[model samples]
Target: MPVDSCHFRTKPIHRNTLNPMWNEHFQFTVHFEEMCFLRFAVVENNSSQTTAQRTLPLKALKPGYRHVQLRTQHNESLEVSSLFIYSHRTEEGPAGGATASSLVRFIQVCCF
Candidate 1:
């Protein structure tokens, strides 16, 4: 994702032992609008002696879309990102970014 000119290239975390709250993942390897899958490993980093892993595979999620949110069981968040098919060329989604006032107005209009 592009953030303040830091254009990033995302890659799937093949084996990461993350908090239980993290479910969704972003797959950025495939060509834009193409299908890809998520593969992950849940690990506990605090333990010093041993290696542990929990595999979470993507069975059936819609293609051309990615939604990832990393959060801890305590509701603490680490990171979040997503990519989706709007056009074949990579671009930001509609309403992807907005000011607080604009978002509030949008919410109001949608609700009203």
Candidate 2:
């Protein structure tokens, strides 16, 4: 997904099993959390077309792990998987820096 026109991506993990684990981490510097929305897409490695996609608001997200029911663009049920999200704000910082007073939201979407 691209945040504010800047693309950020994670490396794809290939496994023979049905359940593949990727213990990875991604970090981003966000300017406006309230105005931000997440766009998630799942595409086949051999194809350019997206099989599943979702655009979600940052404020609607919650911390910790939970199951997210995915749907295609047609609104049909796609899959149900686990997701984990975490957010942190600093108490003191320079101007324009993230602080507790200033609003900042974090969202993590992981499919299991």
Please name the candidate that would achieve the greatest lDDT relative to the true structure.
2
Task: Identify the leading candidate in terms of TM-score.
Answer: 2
Residue 65 miss distance in model 2 (angstroms)? 1.7
lDDT of 2 by residue, 17-112 (tens): 245454555444555666777666665666767666666675565545544555686757766532333433323345766555464333344444
- Compute the lDDT for candidate 1: 0.28
Distance (Å) between predicted and true CA of 109, model 1? 27
Model 1 segments more than 4 A misplaced:
1-29, 32-36, 47-59, 63-112
Q: What would the per-residue lDDT of candidate 1 be over residues 5-108, giving only the tens digit for each residue?
A: 11122333346424223333322322221222333222334542223221122234433334434344443554542122211112333366854333221000
Q: Give the TM-score of candidate 2.
A: 0.63
The Cα RMSD of model 2 versus the native structure comes to 4.3
